[model samples]
Target: MMRLTRRTEYGLMALAWLARAGGRFHSVREITENLDVPRRLLAEILKDLSQAGLVEAVRGPGGGYRLREDPGRLTLGRIVNVLEGPTIFAECYQGDCDLSPRCTIKRGIGEVARRLEAVLEDFTLEEVVHGPAGAPAPSPSS
Candidate 1:
């Protein structure tokens, strides 16, 4: 059941698209049209990503958005955090459970969440773009 929200998904998709396009500034309209994502939602997600310093926004005619840093330097975890805030696998893991001190389940869940986050942190945006060469680009829907 662990899944990235639609916002994060679209953000990554847009980022990957930008990466493939090689640092080109792509307008929101172009992104929405090519990616089949909702225009309003993509705008909000792009804004969030820009605010997080993950993407850069340019204004005026012929201006648009592009990645603020190299794709190889951007981690998936960071993008997810930007779009969705901190990733927490379980509510009880946030020290909210009355039985936290004695709950074995909470401890196990925390470990799993940490491991998952670690995996995400290790995967950079570049890995998503190139996709082992001849392999087809991984679709966001996957």
Candidate 2:
């Protein structure tokens, strides 16, 4: 089954936390303490986000990381890409298979991956964590 990796999951959680923090810098310590994510891993993820221009980072005691772009405008696909490259729904999607020359499932599975990616591109981070108007996000089961 398709699922998010731990690294990508943590990235999303950290972004959601920063979004809830409003327009203020929050240190890694504070983020780690609250989110319970590992400091080292979170640091690496934040660096990637910062390099990707998704987050603004500052050094110094009072310096921290914050969203560079509005969360409402940040797509989930973009975030996932920044943190984890791209979505791979199945092995055949990568084109490394020896069976690619005559693979029957490759085309169909690739289409599904593309469609799912389009959905991700349209769904913003804010909407993912909070419903349209600050309503609690509905679980996938909903």
- For each candidate in turn, the TM-score is 0.84, 0.84
lDDT of 2 by residue, 38-117 (tens): 99999999999999999999999888999998888999999989888866677898877675677789878888888889
Find the candidate with the highest lDDT and give its number: 2
lDDT of 2 at 139: 42
TM accuracy, model 1 = 0.84
- In model 1, the Cα lDDT at residue 101 comes to 68
* lDDT tens per residue, model 1, 30-95: 887778889989998898888888889998787789998989999999988888888767777777
| Model 1 weakest 10-residue run by lDDT | 133-142
* C-alpha local distance difference test of each model: 0.83, 0.85
